[model samples]
Every structure is written in C-alpha cells, then in structure tokens.
Target: MLPDPIHILKTVYGYDAFRGRQAEIVRHVMAGNNAFVLMPTGGGKSLCYQIPALARPGMGLVVSPLIALMADQVAALRQAGVRAAALNSDLPGEERRALWRDIRGGTLDLLYVAPETLLKPDVVDRLATVPLSLIAIDEAHCLSQWGHDFRPSYRQLDALVARFPDTPRMALTATADTPTRAEILAHLNIAESDAFIADFDRPNIRYAIQEKDNPRAQLKRFLMDHEGESGIVYCLSKRRTEETAAWLCAQGYDALAYHGGMDKAAREANQARFQHGEAIIMVATIAFGMGIDKPDVRFVAHIDLPGSIEAYYQETGRAGRDGLPADALMLYGMEDIALRTRFIEESEAPDQRKRMERQKLDSLLGLTETAGCRRQALLSYFGDRCQPCGNCDTCAEPPHLFDGTIAAQKALSCIYRTGERFGQAYVVDVLVGAEDERIASFGHDRLSTYGIGKEHDKRTWRAILRQLIALRLVDVDLSGHGGLSIAEDGRDFLRDKATLMLRVPAAPRPARGKLAHRQASTALPEADRDLFQALREKRMEIARLQNVPPYVIFHDRTLIELAAARPASRADMAAVAGVGEAKLTRYGPAFLAVIAEHGKGLRA
Candidate 1:
C-alpha cells in the first residue's frame, strides 16, 4: 500500500520522472520477475538494475567480466554513496574474504564479480548461501557465441543461474541483434524473461567514411578539428595505437595509448588518466570499450574498418555518451575489407560463425556505401525506424551521385585487358593514359582498353575506381591480391548482364570548429552546470528513496533544460519538454525547493 521506492528516487536522486521503459523494467525486476534490457550506450541501462539492487532488501549480485569495469562501476556507485564492493582476483585474498563476509552480513547493497569467479565451486557454494535479491549480467551479449566480444567463460553463467532459479535475474547489453538476443536467452535459459529494447539510434553522432589515402594526414585533420575534445581512436594493432597516441601527443594534444599488450599497471594508469579527464584522446584496441563509462567522448574514429556492424556500433556508441554532438569517422579501403575476410577465412570458428562474420562485414560495408540516411540504415538493422537525423555527414552534406554504368564498363574492360594482375594505381595509370615505366613494363599501353578513358582526369578516374570498389562491382584479387579483378557483378556488366549506378564523391568540406562551445551555450551556464549536476544528484537520491529509476521522477535532460531556463514555478516547469501533468503534480514542490534554496544562497 506504501508508495514504494518511487519517493526515494524523487528525494534522493532528484529525478521527477522515468525515461522510456526504465520504470517498467525496474518494476518487473523488483517484483522478483526476470528481465533482459537492450538499451543503447547512453540509454541509462545501469539504473534498470542498480536502483532495484539498492532498494531491494538484499544485496544485488552483478556478474561483470572485466576487472576494470567492475572497479569503475563500484567506484561510481560508492561515489554516489551506495554501499558496494567487488570481489575479484585483483583484490588481496584477505580483502576478498572480507567482501564475502560483508555480503553475507547484508552490509553491501551490490556485489560485482567475474563470471569465472561465480563458477568456482567454492564461490558458487558460498554465493548460493547469500541473501541475494537479484542476479544481473552487465554485458550480456558476451554470453552469446554469435556476439563479437564472445567469451567462453560466460557459458558458466547458466550453471550459476540454475543454482538460484528462484532469484530474479536481468541481462543487459548495448548491442545485440535478434540472433544474438536469442542466443543470450537460450544460453542463459531465460527465454521467457521480459525484454526491453531501447531504440538503437544514436542521434547525436555524425557518421563519416573517408577514402583512406594518406591516412595519417586524414587522422591528423580529424584530430585538429576536434582538438581538446574527448575521443577514442581504435586501431587494429597495438603498434598503431602507440604510434597514433604518440603522434597525437606530439601535436600538442593529451593522448595515451592502451592495448592488452601493455602491462596492467600502465594500462590502468592510461585508463585512469582518460577517465579523470587528464587525457583527451585514447588510442586503444578493441579491449578498451567494454566497460568504458566516460559520458563525454566527442568522437570515435576507426583507422580501418571494424570486423562487424555490431562491433562498429558498440565502438562508435562510446562517443557522444552525454547525448551531445559527436562524430563516428571510418577511414577504409579495399585492404580493410580483405583483412577482415582473411580473419574470417583463417579462423578456426565453425562455418556458421564464419558466415555470420561475413554477413556482419557486409552490413558494415553497406553502411559505408549506402546513399540514403546512414542513421536510418543503422537503426533499421536493429529494427528501429527513424527519419533522417539531419546530423551525420550524409544527412548534412549528402554526396553527389553519378551514373557509373559506362565508367564501370570501361574500368572492367581495363582490368580484363591487364589480365586482372594490376592494382588500382596501375589501372588508374592506364585509364588516365599514363604511359609510365610501370605501364610500359606491363605492356598495358598496347591494350585496347588503355587510353580509352583519357578524357577524364586522374583524380576523376581514381574516384570512379574507388566507387567501383565500394559498390563491389570490381573485386580485388586477394592473390596478387592487391590487383584488380572483375567481380561477378563486373563480369555481368561487361556482358551487359547488369547495370551499375555509383555515387560521385562529393567535394571535401572544410572542417568545422568543435561543437563544445555551442553545446555548453545551449545547456547550463559554465558555473551553473555543476549546480545543475548537484540538483540532479539530489533528484537521484529522491528517486532511490522512492525505489524507482531516477528518470521516473525527472529526466537528466529535463533537469539540464530547467537549469538553463531557471524556471521557478509549476507553470514554468510545465513548459519544459518531458515535464507533464503527473510529474508536475508529484515533483514540482521538491524541484522548486532545490531551486529556491540555490537562489537564496546566490542572492546572499
């Protein structure tokens, strides 16, 4: 009959409302029902489980795979004054024992552990005896073999869950398609749990794909455009991460490199520096993103194409976590595609796995080349509909397009004439009528296809060649491997069996200034942003006391909008977006109380 923990959220967390399905998800779990949350990067996924853990009578068991993530989450929760502890191998044995004792004594609200630890025979036996209100899996996608960041250890989770079937369980991830989602359910044997799918659209990120010529120069230009803004640069190799980080530092930016190859001490040091805002850029391999909770990353760049769209989404999702404008830039070429294929071809994974990988790669390529709205394509892949976001490069500056049917025929004929042994540069030479020594050595000057397309400039021919490759009309011979070969589509074009329409590369636009100032100008004043955060902290406390997600009382953006507008009365508050009748009736007094208190102090 009591109002439950919703009042706690209003008083403690300073939130007057819930955003999206957070309240629904929280209730299902709090009532001892199982849940599976599919929220995007900045979708407030943590609170779906964290709030119930605090409000519930017993400690919440959180199974996290990474020590760094666990440490970060535990630190953040403690900072918010929640009683939390993590038991991991990184801690001293004595500390671990003490944590277990504390959990047993009901002194902790939440406890985080690695899945490996959860499966230990002794640990499982001990955990089974604890007063656990719920079991939560943080990165649940890792449990699926179909997932990009798959871990075999996560299979152990099923056994742990089997031991505590009566306890409520929730699995959460930022990226998972239908297949991976099903895999998580079946693997954990929780197929019937209530599923909450947050829309996958990242509205603030502008997606850009540039040809990777002079890649370092292109990267430098990108860094210059976003100087002093926070971002992550993902590299395919450790050496590249270090080199790029060093180069960024040389360019007078705060940059550091992180890879699994680094010593634990060094990696932690770099990660800590990045977390605390001491470094503006982190050049890292894939290991860097999993539990990264930094909310202000302005951009994410891939010097090469990632292996899958899911991986690409998860990586790029790390950017613009504050729901602000960010960029997702990829510099890709034929080599990146080949590299990814080689990985799939050489891996010991089963055929199904290989096929899945290929499908994901193809989806990523589709993203790079699609002429329609990029965000729409990305969201549609995850089963969400969206109008053009009007934010990405394709939306802001749509590419110029040309009919490339004739160009395709000419290029395909050149490749066939060259015996499919020549790469783009050599082919470009023949098309541009360049009778260089390399062309002379190959006798390409004598070919019927040579000099036929000399009417176009070298740059024009190069653009046509790049577009052809992007459209998959021409295949690069993986053996000789850099050389050009007509793909099935190109052969069809040569035989008049198919027609190709290719996009004309748009003229490059000058880089704009960082959007940080514009962002700050639109939000709270520099001085009041901290105060706004304090007020939200108070709102979160209120929400927690009431046993609801913070947003159920007041969304963070609404609070920020209020802070910017500085509304004093219910009428003023009602005018703000997302603050409706119910929220006004319930939360107007508490929010006004904080505003009045802050105003009084300022006037004094």
Candidate 2:
C-alpha cells in the first residue's frame, strides 16, 4: 500500500493537515477517479493534487498553461526534494534530452507540460510508453469559451481523456462562475458528482472600489498604504501600463512595466525581477498575471475597469496568497464602462456570447456601484453568500443614500427630450444649463428638463446617471459613441413616478498610515523584527545565488515563524511549519545559524 497521505504531507510538505476538501480530493484521485476542483486562489489547491501524485504509484503529469508558472512550481517542488520538471519550448536541447531521460527512467515524480507541447504527436507517443500516476490540468477555466481567459488550445485537451483512459484526471481553477464550471466539467468529461466547490470568498483581502476621480492621485494614495511592499497595479491598456510605471518611478517607487507590447526579453526580465525582488511594484495590463505564483503580493490595484468579475477576482486574488492581510482597490468611471460595452458590442463573438458578456459586465457594474458590503455582492455573483464582512469599504464606512426619484426623472427626461442622441457629458451639460454652444445649437437649452436638475451639481448628476445605467433604467448606445437612452424600465419608472434610492458619493478614505505595513510586520515582536529582516536578507541572498525566486526556498510566513519561534536546533527547525525534511536538510542549518547569531547579539 502507498504511504499515508498525512505522513507525506507532514514529512514531504510540512503541513500538519489538509485544508478544506484537499484530503478528500486527494483520496478520490488516489483511488483512480476523476475530479474537478473549484477553490479560491491561495486555498491550497496545489497540495490537493501534489500529495496524491506523491503517494500514488507512477509519475504525475500536470498540464499547465504558462512557462513561468510551470518553472516556478518545478523550482518549488525541487526545493522540497520532489523530482519535478517541466517541458516547454523554453527548454534547451540538452535540458530537454535530460528531462526525457528522467521521464523514461521513471525517476521523475511530477512533470508539468504546456498543453501545446503535450499535444504534439511525438511527445504524446513518448508519454504513452511511460506509467502515469494521474493527469492534472491547472488553470482549467481556460477550456471554457465563456471564461475570461479562454484558450482555444485548452479545448484540444479532451484528447488526453481518450488517450489516458485508466489514469485518474483532475481539473482545477481559482476563478470560474457557474457556466464556466459547467463548461469545464462537460468538456473534461468529469462527472458532476466528482466536483468539489469551495466557498469563493477571500476574507483576508479588503475590497475597496471608488469612482475614478483623478485616478493617478487615487492610485498613489492607495500605494501609500502599501509602501515598500510588492504589489501589482493593473491598467486597462498597454500604454497606460507604461505610463503608470513611469509615473510611479517618478514618485520614487521601484516600478517596472510589463505588457504584451513590450519586447519579449524585457517582459520576461521584468517578471523575473519582480519575482526575485521584494518591494517592487509591477504596473501591467491583463497580460501580466494569469498563472503567477508569488505569495506575498500585499495589494492589487486596478486603475481601470476589468472585463468581468472573474477577471477582477482573479487579478485581485493575486494579493496576500500567503493568507496575510491585503487590499484590492479598484477605480472606475463612466468612460471605462462605455469602453467595455463598446468592445463587447463590436466583438465578433456570437449573439449568445455577446449577451452573456453584457450580463457579466452588468454584474461587474453592480459590484462597483453597490452600497452594501462589497464582499457580499462579489460572493453573490458566484452563488455564494456571506454576512456583511467588516473587511470592505462599505462595511467600514457605509455610503449615505438619498431619494433619487426626482433626479432620475430629470436625467431620463433629458435623454428622452434630447431624442436620446447625446452622450453623458452633453446630457449633464444640458441638465445643469451649461452655457455651451452645442446645447444652444441643438435647441436643448429651452427644454423643460434643461435647468430643472440644477438642484444637483454636475458631478452629482453624473453619479446619478451612472447609477441609472447600472440599475438598467438607462441603456448606453453601442454605436461607438456613448449615447444614453431610457430603457423600458426607465420609461415605466418615469411614468409610475417610482422612488429610487441612490448612493451619495462618498469621499475617498484617507490612507491608513502604516496600518497595512504594520499588519504585515506585526507578526514579529519589536525584538524579533531585526531577526526577521536578517532572515529575509539571508533568504534573498540564497535565492539570488541559486537564481530562483525567494519564495521557492521559503515564504515570508515561514520566515516570520522562524523569527518568532527562534528554532534552536535542527529538530526545532524541522518542527516549524513549511520546514519539511528536504527543506530542513537543505536550509535548516543556515537559518539556525542566523538565529544563533541574533541570540548572541541580544546577550551582548
């Protein structure tokens, strides 16, 4: 019989117990069964498959999407003494030959391959000769066309099911809505009964959404809370990424830009730098963070809107992967929504797909405009519910609501009276009776709804209009120009004189000076702070020497534990969390020496 999984977990991985459904999924896979896993990012999804792969008889084959992701996982596994390797186009001839030798020699435990490389005829034929333990598809949502990050190559993976009929298979992803989940299950030939769905809440990430008002200023303020920390600032466009990165550098931040538009070498080098260095801010587009494995991202800020909630969740989920306190701050405005809608309407996707995209956009807009707990609204999108989490902006400072019936009527009537041909700026201008030449030339200056909305300022009127659009009381024209028209519901709302409650725009919250920074460092006592820093320096030094990311050797959490516990001997260090046998043997003595020196210094 195979060794006990718990024994493998403690001895090989150094975790005391499995988290959530990890143990159950491992057992199911180990029993030669297929499974689908939907867990949040940083929810120990890797262990669910890694443990089974170790305990099973043959080498496990993992299908990953990105080379960086595969390389990082392989590095971490090797550091833990697992014979893991990856096959990708980036591998040199000698390395590729050696990896195949290991695979044929039955010396590899887990092998991660890209879908494209694995699907090649020669690779498949070669793999067919080897005894396989299990097949795992990470980032499995890419198989679903409905998913935000769909890849056509993922659809071709069904061939694996037919080719490896007896080997157990599992599909895993961190962000998949209901439809995406069903698509993955259907495409992978996994039974519904075998799926494990965990709660889609990341309670550790404090969610904050603000209406875009001087976005650069807002982003800078958010960054103040995360000073000297590693974070990602996502922009909507490649140009914006470069500009933001440059601006951040001007402000004395160690910032770098990464996007598809950059040269390949530069992009890879920037990613490598961000991965290996601490306190570096990476300003990037959506192209940057699909399968990143960094564990200590303290914040994820989006200066522009993401495509959907799944995209938003996946991007923000990158932060605090080590389960520490982190922040997800997003800033959006009317232009962002219009741009997203225009992209959807102009896309070549089928009508059904377009409708689904519109619905997803609507859901995301609702999240942005929600006056309730952001977490509750976010979870509700995934068919999960939670109590009003005190961790979000609304829960911390609830927005004030006002009777928006009159304001809505005036805004909708202005759009209707103007023949619904104008965009938001013209409508707002007409409402506030601006002395603009276009208003007079269009004869909208004399309309009954012209100056009637003067009770609210231009900013307030814009907010009202946005809330109307979010509520489906108004429709944005998809004709490349952002014209506003009253929806059927808006007509009824106007006719029936319905009451509407809209949020009064709240001022941006001030930076919680050193609060976030303190939370990250507070695990160590005042006396242990120096030791923690020293340990971190040592980790960085060793990581640089090996040319690998620091976390591959040990995570910040493990370092914090060492500083607090000050493990005196090899046995004591081995007992610490994240210190498995391989890591203890390789890294324990070095860490213990640091602790010993720190102790001597204290005595002195």
Candidate 3:
C-alpha cells in the first residue's frame, strides 16, 4: 500500500539517513501508533512526519498553527517533489475549492490546515469524508494552557482523537519543557510509551550570555563576526525595538522593526521580506519568531533577559534551521533582573502564577550567571543532560574563579548592619567605604562593616552582589522598597555553613572566529573560503530565479560538502549528501559549474 520510509526519504527528500530519533518516530507513526515528539528546531522534525506521509496510504493531515508557517512549510515540501497543499484563510476562494476537490480525489499526500480551520464544523465534516492515513500537529506546544504560544483552538482538537480513534496521531514541537510535553501527550491521548523526546540539544547553536556593559557597543562587537549574515536582535519592548532598528539602520545595517503595535499591512510586508531576502536583520519583540520556518538565519541575539528558559530556547532556535552552525547571544544586566523581580511581585497576575513566573525567571538568571556550561544548565531545565559544550563562552574562555568567602560575608554584614532596607548600590557603597551623602546622613560610614571591602573595586563588589542574588543568598525585595534582605540560604553562607566561590567579572571575550561552530560548513580549509562564498552567491542567484529561500534550493551544508568534495559533474554531485534525484536534476548543473571554475583536484 505504500513505499518504504527510507526509500521515500532518499528518493524524495534527498536525505540519506535520519538523525537521532527521527527514524524511530517515523516507524512508529507509520505503523499507526500515536506519538508525541519533542525535537529542536532545524533538527529535521518535519521529516519524521513527511516520510511517513509519503509511505502511508492516504493524505497525512497536518494541523499547523499559523498561516505564514503553513504556507512556508507547504512551499518547501513541494520543492522537494512531495505532493502538498495548504488549506487556510489566506487561500483564495477558488483555490480553496480546487484544493478541496483534490483532497477528496485523494491526490494530495499531505494537507496542512490551520487548527482554526480544522476545528470548523463544516471543514471537519468535509475532511472526515476523505481517508487520512495519519494526523500531524506541528507546534504542538500551543496546546498547553501555560505554553508560550498557547491558543484556544488547540483545546478543541481533542475532537480529532474522538472522531478518528483508529487513525494514528503525532504531536510535534521544537520547544516544549517537561510540563508542556506531558500536556501534549495527555491532550492527544498519546500514551507515555509513545512519546519520543529527542535530546533537547541544538548542538549547531553556540550559546553565549554576557552581562550588559555598553550594550550598544557590546552588540556591535557581537555583530562584527556576523556581518552580512541573516540574524535577529530581540528587544524587550516595542519602543526599544523601534529605536534599536533605527540605530542599526543608521549604522548602515539592513534592519527592520516588527511588533504588534505596527500596522498590520506593514508587519506582513516586513515578514515577507525577511522570509525572502538574505542578510536582513529583524529587530523584534518576542512576537516575531514563533513558527518561523526560515532555515538560514545565522544568529539570534537578545538585548535583554527573556522571561524563562523555554522562551529563550524557542526564540534563539529561530537560527540555523539548516543544521549549519549558528550563534545565540544575550546581554542581560542587574537592572533587568531587578525590574523583572519587581514586576513579578507587584503585577496583578495570580499569586500562584506570579510565583511560578518568578521561579522560571530564577532559572534563567541561574543560566545567565552560570560559570559552568550554559548549554548543560539550559538542557537540564528541560530534563535533558549534556556535557560541557566547548562552543559556549564559559567553556571557550572560563572566567577567573576566586574564593569570595570574605567578600560574601562583608556584603552580607553590610546588609545586616544597615537594616537590610537599602538598595544594592547603597549596600555596595557601604561595603566599599563610599562617603556618599546617604552614607554620611545615615551614619553608615561609622559602622564597622564600612570600609572593610576597600581591597575590591566597585565592579568586583557588584559582581559579588549579583552572584549572591543568583545563588539565592540575597533576595531583592520589591514590595518593601528595592532592598537586599538575607535569604535563609544567605544566613548559612554568613555563618560559614557554605563557602562562596565567585567568578570575577572578566573583560568581555571577543566573539568567536567566523568559523565558530566550525562544523560541517566552517571546517573547510582557508583555501576553500573563497570558493564557498562564490558557491553561496551562485546559490542566491539561483534562489532569486526560483523565488525561494536559498536554503530551500540547497542548504549551506550541501554547498560546504560540494566545496569540500569538489564534485566535477552532475554524476559526481550525486555522491554528495542532500543530492536527491529531483534536486540534482534542478540545481546540480549550476552549482557544478561554479565548483568547476573555482575548485581543482576534484574528488573522484
């Protein structure tokens, strides 16, 4: 009744093998068993369902969340020679009617519909008449009540399970924590035995977090290695987004601002341009990146701290969807932490909700201040484990670790003697023996704790305070004036029940070399750099002709393979990975010609 999954993958999609749990998920779904999948963005999550869709007997119905994402995915699937169609509100009436005809005629291998569309009674009535081999729900995290992209339409999808009890169902997402994963399974009635949680590691993404210092200058330094590349810069507020975009534009970068407050038409146009153009940077709020299907985004930088690790993972994951090396950088400061703490305490969000939000914020703060592997801490939040990744800033250039036992006690003593009602600045000033008016007026200068920390500079003292806050030794009270109060844990440290080891606030490490991840794409010899650039230019030229993302034509990994292997002809190109019959037939000659001109000593 169907072709083999491996056969469809190679012959249609051009990939030779499945990575990690993809093959296993494909097999399970193909056998009509339900599955809940959690894979990172650009980890080939689509293939797990696409391959089975091709192998199954009837159309594979996909419930996607956004109209843009549905269109983007359908376009890419068609480019790979798969029969795909998207039925959404964006389609013209005639086109919708025609697609319905095709669906009823059973001509489509895959049909992508918005959850809103699928939940319509009439639309459901229409789709039920056709045979569906399997159901795939993309961005399944939205189904959860507490998920970042929660939508109520997903709540009604449970009817699909009741309606088609015999049909296999698969829920998929790139970013979902353990709670979200459990919710997805429970909502879809997918047993835990069928849930496949792939390693939450995006090994292609090099993670780095820096304390905010001269943010504009620091952002420029981070952007230096990534010049002329496609990336995103996230700001916390709409005003910041607009200002940063304008500043980047004035600085001669091709940048645009996107936020909910913008005109609807303008927003849609900007989204299209970013999706289609290369080397364009979008400075946006958290609103811009959900379900973005672009594959060639090289980096995602944040100018402020995100609310949670799940939010951070989902936003930064917009980069490197092609499995090529990418970068994730964030600049956060003590002010940001204090502001977030204040908001959590004062906001009208339910007490339980605020508490949970504060807990999530603490987790992200822990990740930001971690002197060890950021990736390991990040993955651990999702109930995954990984070794120290050498790609992160901490693993790349470890900070100076020093025994801060005395420094901790000094800061704590200052908070204690000053009545624990002063802001961190006042406390730090008291420790550093500052003769400020507040210190003189409050007689803090007369205290014995004053001037005890004269050996360390203000910056060092601030680092100690920040680390103390991160370790929960010092709590920043928002409701009772912004002041430092000793947490229960801080009392232990003050009494010598615990020792303090703090990382010195080191000067900023320069961004890693261009070949940072130095994986498949960047591992080429220095001699091959020019050739790779030429290949990329040629790919762009071809993409302009086809009106698709260059990656949709051929991924950067494919070009790197070509540059390394230096294939001499179409026949030779067939040996390279990602060269299926359809793609090679379409793009092989052009890329081969570029390689022939630039590369010598071709691989036989």
Candidate 4:
C-alpha cells in the first residue's frame, strides 16, 4: 500500500494543507489516472505532482524543458529531504552513474529529465527496466503550436507517452489560452474531463500600463517604488537591454544585461548573480525568463509591448511568486503596435495561423486600450472573469472619457485628404495646421481638413489618432514608408457618422517618496523587522556556503513566519509552515539560536 499524501505534505513538504485543486489533482493522479493541470504561476503546480510521486510506490519521472529549471527544482527538493535528482548534461560522469544506479536500485523518489535526454534510445532502454510510478510534462503549453512559446521538441513527447502507456501521465502549464489548452489536450491524449483549470488571477500582483512617453523617465519613476528589491526589466532588443543596464548602473543601481547574443558564460554569470543576490536588476530580452523558479522577484517592468496577451501574461507572472505584494508595469505606444503587426504580417505562417495571430494581437490591444479594470480584461481573454480588481492602474485612477467622434473624423478625413501616404507625425502636423514644407509640398495646405483640428494641440491630435488605430478605425501601412490609411471600420464609421468615446491621456504624476524597504519586511511589526533581517542574513550565509540560491535554503515566506512566531524549540519550529522534517532537522537549531539571541537582546 502507498503512504498517505497528507503525511508526505506535512512531513516531507511542510505545507499545512493543499491549495485549490491540488488535493483533488493529487488524489486523481495517485489513483492511477492522467491529468492536465492549468494553474497560474506560483499556484503550487509542482506540489501537485511531487506529493503524489512521494506517496506512490515507484519512482516518478518529470520531463522539464530547461536545465536551469531542473537543477533548481532538484536542489529545493533535496533541501526539503526528498530523494530527487535531475538527469541533465550538467552532471559529472560519476554523478550520472550514481544517479542511474539509484534509479535502477529503486532508491530515487523523483527524477527530472530534459525532453531531449529522455528521448534518447539508450536512456529509454535503461529506463524501461525500472518500474515507474507516473510521468509529468512540465511547461506543457510548449506542445501547442498555438501557444506563444511553442517548442517542436514538446510535440515529440508523444513517443515517450507511447512507451510508458501504463504510467499515469500529467501535463502542466501556467500559460495557455482556450485554443492552446485544447491543442495540448489533443496532443497529449489527456481527456478533457481530467483537466483541472484554476483561476488565473494573481491578486498579489498590481497591474499597471502607461503610454510610452519619456520611457527612461517613466521607468525611473516606476523603479522608485521598488528600490533595493530584485526585479526584471524586459526590453525588445539586445542593444536596448545593454544600454538600459548601463544607464541604470550610471544612476547607481546594480543592474546587469542578459541576451542571447552575449557570450554563454557571461550570460550564465549574470543570470547566476540575479538568482543569488537580492537587489540586482536583470535587464534582458525575452530570451531570459523561461522556467525561472525565483519566488521573490518583486517586480516585472516592460519598456516595450509583447506580441500577445499570452506572452505578456507569462512574462509578468514571474513576479510575486511568493504570494506577496508585487508590481507589473508596462509602457507601450503606437510604434510598438505597428512593429508587432508588421511582424505578424511578415511571418511565414499559413493564412489561418496569421489570422489567429491578428486576433490575438487585437485582444492584446483591447487590453491596453480598455478603460475598465486591466485584470478583468486580461482574465477575460483566457475565458476567465472576476470583479473589477482595485489593484490595477485603471482601478486606482480611472481615466476620463469624452466623445471623440468629431476628433476621429477630423484625423481620418485628414488622412484621406492627404492620399493616406503620410505617417503620424506628418498627418498630425497637417491636422494641427503646421506651416511645414512637407505639407505645402504635398498640396495639403489647400485641403479643408488641414486646419480643422487646430482646436486640439498636436499631442491631443496624435493621441486621438493612436486611439483610432487601436480601435481599428485606422490601419498602418507597414509595407510603404509607415503610412496611414483608413481601415474598413474607419470607412464604415465615417459613412454611419457613429459616435465614439476616447480616453483622455493622463498627465504624468510626480514621483512619490520611497515606500517601505521590502514587502516581506514591511509586513512584520517594527520589533520583528530586525529579526527578519537577521534571519535573511543567516539564510544568505548558508546559501553561499552551499552554492545554491538563497530561496532554496528558505523562502522569504518561511523567514517571515519564523520572525513572527519566534519559535523557541525544534518542535515549535517543525510545526511552522514550510518546515518539513528534513529542514527542521537540518537548520532548525541555527534559526532557533538566532531567535534566542534576538529574544535575549529584547529582554535587556
């Protein structure tokens, strides 16, 4: 008979209870059934598989995508006292042999392998000899071509499934839309009835998006709220990442640049620093953040737009994995939209796929342009819904909306009168009656729509045009000199004389004073703050000695519990959440001593 799952959760993993659907999923998997889990980041997806792996009779095999992710999970599991090991290219010769021996000897509880490594014939033959408890495919969204981060290697996982037909299989991902989920189910042969879809809301994260104006200044203002905290700043280009990192360093911030173009060793070193240190900011392109398991990233800032809502959701979901207050800020403008559209139009995909991409882009634009709650719109894209979350920028300070039909008419008429050949700058100039040579050269000065928009300034006129483009009333001609033209919707609106509402561009707010140090520390009382820092220092010291990320030793959440409860004995510490039998036995004394020291000092 198998051990009880709650026993493993309490003694091996140290969680008081299973979170939403985790208990159900665990029970189902342990019953020798397959499952497809769609949980958000930090939603305890790993625990859903890990607990069952320990409870079941034989070894559990996990298929992971990246080596770093596998290594991180292995380290954390071993620290928690579970017999976990990752079979990857990074292991030394003797270490690999020992792991294989343990696997063949039935001494390993769980093993993580990259898809490439697991697909090898020799490895498959070796694994066929051992009895397997279950198989889990992590980041299962990669199997769907409709997903934002599709991997062809994941499609080939069907071979492994065919080989291990008797093993109960589970597929897991944090990001997948309706179509992506359907495709994943079809590819994995997992029945729809077995899928467990959780709510996609990350209430701990505050969403905010701003129109790109003085991007550097805007980013600086955003950073003021997140001082002395670890975060990621994503840029669209490698040059931008390096430049932004250098600029941040000049401003006295410890920033590092990471991109695919950098030397492999250098990129790895930068990633290592960001993972191990608490205050470093990593300026990177999209190449950096897949499968990162860091739980304390305080913020994720985007200086440019992502291609789709899936990409945005996946990238922004990296922050606040510890379920603490975090921030997601994005600055986008008209150019970002045009560039993304050009990318879709220029891709080699089939027409149907291109149409799907266009629809996805439209959904993302709707998210950015929505006057309602950002979270609500974001969740709605994935076929989820919630009440208006008060944490996003739109909820905090709602934008003013006014009838913009007249303004849109003026802008579209100006484009039409000018032969729809000029870009936004030239078109705006013509609308606001600029005495420029280009307008005169194009004979636009004689047009009736030239001076009709003088009531609004150039900035307002440009804002109106951008809104029109976002509303699909105007189309950007990317094939020719980035010209402006009327879309079918624009023509229909003009013919119908339809009324429209547009948001008033918000003026930039003055940067507020620095807030509290860190969310973790601020949550504790003043008296316990010192103890929390001391505990963090101890965790870092131990982590450095062990050459693992500090979070692997003890998460900030665990430290907060220690500081708050001030457990005086090993038994007391063991009762704390996240303190499994292995951890309590390993580091309980050291932490208890720190608490004792703090207590004595307080008495004095």
Best by lDDT: 2
- Of candidates 3 and 1, the better by lDDT: 3
Q: List the residue pairs that clash in candidate 4.
A: none
Q: For residues 1-604, write the lDDT of model 3, one tens digit per residue.
A: 5578887777777778889999899998888899888898888888888888888888999999877778788877777777899998879999989999999999999999999889889999988889998999998998987676788999789899988898899899988877778888888999999988888888889988887777888888878877778899999899999999999999889999999999988988888889887789999998898889888899999998887889999999998887778889899877678777887788887887787787888889889888889899999998899888887888887778999888888888889999988887888888888879989998989999999999998878887888888888888877756788898999987676576788889776665543354444456887787888888899889778877767777777778888888898887898788888888888888888888877554443
Question: Each candidate: RMSD to true structure?
Answer: 5.9, 1.6, 3.0, 1.7
- Looking at model 2, the pairs that clash are none
Which runs of model 3 end up more than 4 angstroms from their true locations?
Answer: 346-352, 416-421, 441-443, 479-481, 491-497, 512-521, 596-604
TM-score to native of every candidate shown: 0.86, 0.97, 0.92, 0.97
lDDT of 4 by residue, 289-338 (tens): 88789999999999999879999999999999998888898998888888
Instruction: Evaluate model 4: give its lDDT.
Output: 0.90
lDDT of model 3, residue 4: 81
lDDT of 2 at 320: 91
Clashes of 2: 0
- Scored by lDDT, model 1 comes in at 0.78
Please give, for residues 1-604, the per-residue lDDT of candidate 1 as tens digits: 3235565455334456767888898888888888889998988788888888877777899999888778777765654456888888889988877887797888998899999887889988987888887899999999988888999898678886679988888999999988999988876667554888887888778887776767778888776667556789999989999998898788788889999999999998888767655127999999898867776677899998887888989999998776867788888876777677678887899999888887887788888887888888888888889998876767767777777777878888888888887888888889878869988887778888888888777767777876677666777665536887888876666777466667776554445622322342246668677658666777767756754335445544667887777789988877776565556776778888888888887899
Model 4 vs. true fold: TM:
0.97
| 1 or 2, greater by lDDT | 2
